[model samples]
Target: EPEVTQTPSHQVTQMGQEVILRCVPISNHLYFYWYRQILGQKVEFLVSFYNNEISEKSEIFDDQFSVERPDGSNFTLKIRSTKLEDSAMYFCASSYRMGGELFFGEGSRLTVL
Candidate 1:
C-alpha cells in the first residue's frame, strides 16, 4: 500500500537557521497536513492544504512556517527560522477527505540547538 514518505529522516540545526522538510503523500489522497509533536507533547496541527491552496492553519503556524505543493507529487514544509522550541518530530499526513483517516509518514525529526 502507498504511504507518506519524508526526507532527511533526522536533522540537526542551529537556532535561527532555515529548514525544509519534504514529503510525498499517498498518490490518490486529496488532503495534506503538517503536524508536529514537541517531544512529549500532543500532536499539534500546523497547517492543511488542498488543491494547491492552504485550507486551514493553527496559531502555532506563525509567519515562520510555510507549506507548499511544489509539484504534483511533492509536498513540503519550510521553517524560515528555527527556534529551540521548534524541535520535534514533524509528521506529514494525508487523507481522501477532510477529517478522514490519515496516512502518516515515519516523520522527519528536527532538532534545533
Candidate 2:
C-alpha cells in the first residue's frame, strides 16, 4: 500500500532559527494535512491543503508558519522561527477522499533548543 513519507525524521534547531519539514503523500491521495503533537499531548491539526490552496487552518498556523507544495508531489511546512513550545512530532497525512480516512507518516520529530 502507498503511504506518506517524511524527510529528516529528526531535526534539532536553535531557538529563533527557521526550519522546514518535507513530506510526499501517497500518489493517489488528494487531501493533504499537517498535524502536530507536543510530547504527551493530543494531536492538533495545523493546516489542510487541497487544489493548490489552503483549505483550512487552525489557530496554531500563525503568520510565522507556512506550507507549500513547491512541486505537485512534495508538501513542505516551514516555521519562520523556532520556539521551545514548537518542539513536537509533526505528522503528514493524506487521504484520497475528503473528510475520509487519512494515512499518516511515521512523523518528523522537531527539537528546539
Residue 91 shift from truth in candidate 2, angstroms: 0.3
lDDT of 2 at 93: 97
- Each prediction's TM-score versus the true structure: 0.96, 0.97
Residue lDDT tens for model 2, 4-111? 999889999999999999999998888999999999999999999999889999999999899999988999999999999999999999999977899999999999
Clashing pairs in 2: none
Candidate 1: misplaced stretches above 4 Å? Answer: none
Best by TM-score: 2
